[model samples]
Structure formats: C-alpha cells, structure tokens
Target: MSLGKSRLWGVVARGMAMGAADVVPGVSGGTIAFITGIYQELLDSISRVGPHALTVLRRHGPLVAWQYINGSFLLSLFTGILISVVSLARLIGYLLDTYPVVVWGFFFGLVLASVIPILRRVPRWNTGAVIYLILGVLVAIGVSELRPAQVPATPLTLFLSGGLAICAMILPGISGSFILLMIGIYPHVLTAVHELQLVKLLSFAAGAVTGLMLFSRLLSWLMHHYVARTLAFLGGILLGSLKIIWPWKLPSDEVAAMGDKMAPLMSNTSPWTFAEVTGESSYLLAAGAAALMAVLIVLAVDFWGHRRGAHH
Candidate 1:
C-alpha cells in the first residue's frame, strides 16, 4: 500500500497518539495502534525486519528491501513517536502531577473505548474464545496486583527493563510505562527522557529495539493464526486494566507506608468517596468530561478509519 503525502502524515499523527498513550502508565500504545487500524500493519512491518529483509537486500537491492518491509511507514511512524515522546514528556509529567484525576480520566476513557475495536476484531465467539478472554483478564489483574520492586540504575538493568517493558508496551492493554513503574524505574526513565540523558536513553532504546524485533514476529504469527482468540484475550486485558486507570484512587496502606517510592500502587475508589478519603476535591465533573472527550476522540478516529477503508 502506497501512502501519499497526506496519508503518510496521517500515519505520523497516529504515531503521535500512540506515543502519547505510551507515556501514561495505564495506557498502551498498542491499543492506540489497534484503534487507529494500523496494529496489524505495524506488527507485520516490524516482523519483516529480520533475515528475510537482509536476503531481499542481497537479492534485489536496498530500495527493494526497504519497500518490502514498508520502511517508509515505519520511519514516518517512529519519527512521530520520537517527536511526541520528546516534546510531551515534561508536559504530560506536569499534568499527571498537577491534575492526576483529569489525566487518568483521559487515559481510562481511551482504554475503555479501545476495548470495543479490539473485541470487534474477533472473527467469531466460541468456548475457546471465552476461556481465553477469562484467562487474559486473570493474567492482567495478577500483573496489576504486583507491588513495585527496587532495582539498581545500572545500564544492564535499564536494558533488561527496557526489553521487558517494551514487550508489554506493544501488547494491547498492557502499559510499558506501568511495567516500568512496577520495576521501579518509571521515574528514572521519565527523567531520562526529560533530561536528555543520552546514555540512559540509548540503553533503553537498544533494549526496546531488541525486544520489538523479537516479539513482533510472535505477535504477528498469533494474530494470523488465532486472531479471534487472541483478540478476545486482548480485549479482556483492556477490561481488566480499568482498575489501574480509574480516576479516583487512594494509596494502599502498604503503599502509603512505603512513601513516595510506591505511590503508583494506589487502590481504586469511587469518585464520591475520594474527597472523604483524601481531603481533596474529587473533581468528578472535570474527570467525567475529560473521559467523555477521550471517548469521543477515539470514536471519531474509528469512524474515520472505517470510512477510509470503505473508500479503499
């Protein structure tokens, strides 16, 4: 599929959205890709960047190899992602710090609405699909329930963390940022982005590339073979993760005792109960509006994608 200039820019815009989603702890960029109707293409493109592409280059030429792997699409998409992560890092960090509920409200709505498209991808429903969905929910909830662990800030650990987190990042409903949070390097990674720490950033990027290459093939194969069950499972993961992104939260007793280091492990609470528990305004109306806006935005994107597909 050749992308004209406008379509190329459209892919970039989608990448920006994905990057923004990735910055948040409870939102996955993979979900954004799925919603924007590019998830499969993205996986296929990445999966091609191995020995097959090298062979193509040897037999044909660099240009043919690049075209075979949809190099322009990957380049344009990642360019947008890089621009967004670099530009929005500080801004998103500030928003999360100052307006936690509103920020989380947007992400929660995004993830919530995203589940529709994901589930819709399932070709058919059956007992196997139902079982996979349930299993996915259980796995997501189990991962969410884990406490944060401390790790050294060494390069090796950062590389490993990057690999692990990137795997989660590309999986629908699983947030790479949240994985970093669980691994106790969320702040450091954010700081590295914000501060332009080249060494740290490069280490993380190396790991991310390694992980992306390794995982994309497996994902593509699963998507090709067991698309229905896989999508069912992914949709269930999105549903199960709603607990983590709930706008109103209170620090668990243990989390409170652990101080700032463990603040991300908060327990979800109702908006009404939030004020009483935290002695702060719940901002329920604001949060609700933000969530509604997010949902509307996703719906608009979905509508546009479908229209484009129909035209094609």
Candidate 2:
C-alpha cells in the first residue's frame, strides 16, 4: 500500500531535508534519508521502476502499477526534493559562499547525529565489522582530501557528471554535489539550476535517472544479502566524512598564496586555532548554536521514528 495520509507529509519533509543536504557540499541527502528512516523504502521503490514496472503497467492498469511501485511515496518525496533544489539551491549556495563555518557547523551536527542510527544497524559486532568501519573511514577521508579538478561543461560532460554524481549522492557518506565540485562541474550545474537552463538540466536529469536505475538494484541486493557488512561499511563512510565537514579552513590561493593557486582552496583547521590560522573571525558561538539545533532536530526525528514503528 501507499503511505497513509498521516505519514505523507513526514516523508515529504524528509525529502526536503535530503534536498537541502544535497545542495551543500559536505552533506548527503542519503544520510538524511537513512536518518529519517526512509532509505530502504527509497531504494526498494526506485529498484522497482525497471522492466518489472513496465510489465506491471502493461498487465495491470495504471493504478496497480502505481501501487506496485509505491508511486505516491516516491512522488511525494521527489516532489519535495525537487522543490527544495529549485527553490533553495540559490539561497543555500549564497550561504555556503558567505558563511562557510556556520553552514558546515549545522551540517556537521546533522551528520554527527546520523552516526547513531547507522551504528545501531550493525546486527553484531566483530573484528570484521571493525575492520570494515576503519576501511570505510579511511576511504572517505582520502576522498575528502582530493582537490577539485576543473572539467568542461559540455553536454556529454554534464550527462556523465550527473550519472557519476548521483551514484555518490545515494550513498550516506558522499555528497553528489561535492562529487560535481570535485569533477569541476558543480558550479556549472548549480548555475543551470539557478538560471533555469532547460537543456543542461534535462541532460543532468536523464543521467540521474539512468544511474538511479542501475545503482538501486545493486544497493537493494547488498541490503538484502549482506545487511551487517553493508551497514558497517556505511557507518565507516559516515564516520570518515567528518573530515570533510570540519568547519574551518585555510585560505585559498585567491586570498593568499597557495601552491595549487585556486580561488576557493581550503584546508581544515581546528576551531580553537581557526582565528589564529585565518586571521579572521571564526563565529564560534554561531557555529555552536547551529550544531546544537541540528543535534536536537535529529534526536526529535529519531523519537518520531520509534513512535511510528510502535504504531505499526
């Protein structure tokens, strides 16, 4: 059955949260989905929209096919994501450019709280799981350290970038926009969204649909067969992503001389030493407040999830 009336709004809100997270460089909408308890449902629904969906649509009426695909839930969720991306992307982009520390601090808390749910999913703890966690963290941290490489914004590049970035966006640890940024096309995509460039946006959307169809199957299979290993590995990835959202950074080459000579280059710095390193205001109080709010919001969502589970 499709989601009930009472739960529909919640799913949309979660999708909005995911979209908001995805717009940020260090945040993943998948992390928001996992934390809000819709991750598996999303994968299941997306995985169904392949040959099986076509067969169902042809054999059964539109109603039956829609129910089989959980169309209402997907529709509600993606609607929210789409609204947020189109409506909020520009504002968020402004915030990130202007108030980097505060933005990261808020996201840092959101991600930090996500770890609790991810870790609890580990069915049993053992040496293997621990090793997996470490490996994930190392991989995430290593990926976080890579510098962005400028790439062309041609139609082919945009299509491939969308496909590749969507794959990472669905992972709890990686941010798809961050992937785009790393590939040097993030600014281009963001501009397209902000400017209503139909051709570029359509190309990106086509790529995303293709990638989602392929990745959802693999992800659903992994979840079904290797639950513990998958969760543990994801936990590690989330843990390691902490390095990416450190909330402090050294100057880019534009501000001061850096060997790479980039305009927005940054290196992570400790909060305590941020002032000393950047010779600028750190806004520690604001950062702390934002982080606190994020933690509280996450805990509230967790409580709501438990209540829903009990009701079911």
Candidate 3:
C-alpha cells in the first residue's frame, strides 16, 4: 500500500483543496473529497487510527502498520490540510468579508455540482432513501434558520467547538466553520489563528483529532452498511445548504471584529430584488460566472478521475 512520491503529492494537493473548502463557513471539505472520488478512502484512512492499527504496529513494526492503515496517505494529506489552514485562514476570512457573494456563489456552485455524482453512487436507491433525503433537507434548513448563539468563548467552549466543528467538517454538507459561527465561536477561533495563539490552536487540534477519530468511524461504517441512505442524507444536506450560500442577502445588525463590514445575520433574497433592497451592486453576472466555473471545474475533476481510473 506504499505510494509513489507523485501519488503522495497528489494526496497533499487534494488535502489542500479540502482545507480551503473547510475554511469557508458554508462549504465542506468533504465535498471536495467526495467530488474527487476519495471520500470513502479518506474515511477508511481516518478510521484506521485506532486499535487495529496499533495492534499491527506492535506486532509487525512501523512499516507494516503504516502500510496497513494507509498511514503515508493520511499523513501527507493531513499535513497539507494543516499547512493550508494555517496559511490561508486569514485570506479566506478576508474574502468572506469583502467578496461575500462571489465567494459564496462559487461554493454554492461547487456544492450543487457535487450532488449528482454523489447521489448516483448510492448502493441502492429506493423510497426510503428519498424520505431520508427529504428529512436531511429539513434538518439542514432548520439548522440554517437558527440564530447564532452569543456564547462565551472559554477554553471548554473552544474544545467543544473544535470537536463539533471537526465532525461537521467531515460530513458532506456541514461546514465546520458554520458550526462555529452558529455557536458564536467562529470569530474567536479565527482570531486565534490570525494571532498565532499556540495554546488555543493546540487545544483545538487535540479536540479535532479526537472528533475525527470517533466520527469518521461512524461515517465509514455507514458508507459500508447503509450507503444509499447516507448518500441521500448527505446530498440533501448539500441541497439545504444552498439557502446559506444564496448570493443575495440582507444583513442583520450583528457585527464581528474579524469582518471589516461583516454582518452577523443575513437572510437570502432573490437576485432580481437584491440591488433594489440593499442599494448595492448585485454582481449577478459575476456570481453567475463563478457558479458556471464551479460546475465546470467539478465536472472536469470527475471526468478526469474516471479517465484515470480506467487507465489504471
């Protein structure tokens, strides 16, 4: 299971893409993994971080355990993810503030484009899967509707936020940053990253690792045993999140320091009515172009992946 250097580098590149997506509040890194055809493999790799891997390590030594658990791939991927997050967090935060529509519009397209390929992969499609999909949609919408909490950002809170956010990050439709935003921890966490607060960052990382180790197993298990229903639910999540990523929004009074003009609360509005209501340029064409590009990019990736698979 050892990979060539080029293959490891490819994993790193994919991890960077996932990390970039996770930085956005309305985007999931899992979306990148899914669209790129590595979603199950990623889950399997993460799920290997427990007893079986350790037992192998003790019995067969480092190399055997490493290969057995896909350790090289996971290590390279997570290394790239960490590097990307550390380096790009500030830039992404700025984009979210300054070009909200364009950023969200592009990701909206990414998520939308991802739905078909993912849904098609379901092992069995039936009425029950449809019901679960609808249910997932409802739950996601409900989540989107809830107001951001004004909770205090204590150490314990940050730990919990890290755990919850990491769990969300791995789920196809849930955005970890959005979970942080919902709990009023997004800004605080961003501040830590921007300021290079080692203690806070380390604590969050520990929590993230714990959450990933636990939740990824559940996700992997579902993929193996109940893939149809899981895909339907995840697809529904992507569908429902469209509300969050809608291009036009009316801002609420809440403000945060991280955003130069960040509005805390926003409600989606029709594109036609956006400029009239907000008295700002709708940037409809720009957003539409971005959306188009997003769709094209996803299709291209999928097509290329299939081609590569065939070549193999």
Listed per model in order, the count of residue pairs whose N, CA or C atoms clash below 3 Å is 0, 0, 0
Please list all clashing residue pairs in model 2, or write none if there are none.
none
Report lDDT (CA) for all predictions: 0.87, 0.85, 0.85
What TM value does model 1 have? 0.91
Error at 119, model 3, angstroms:
0.8
List TM-scores for all candidates, in order: 0.91, 0.90, 0.90
- Top lDDT hit: 1
Runs in model 1 deviating more than 4 A are 153-156, 187-203, 256-264
Rank by TM-score, highest first.
Answer: 1, 3, 2
lDDT of 2 by residue, 1-312 (tens): 678887898888888888888888778899999989999999999999989899999999899999999999999999989989888999999999899899989988888888888888789898888888898899899888777777877888888888889989999978887778777887778788888999999988888889999998899899888888888889899999988888877755633212234466677777768888767788899998999999899889888886888898
Deviation in Å, model 2, residue 214 alpha carbon:
0.7
lDDT of 1 by residue, 246-303 (tens): 8998876754113244453478889879999888999888988999998998888888
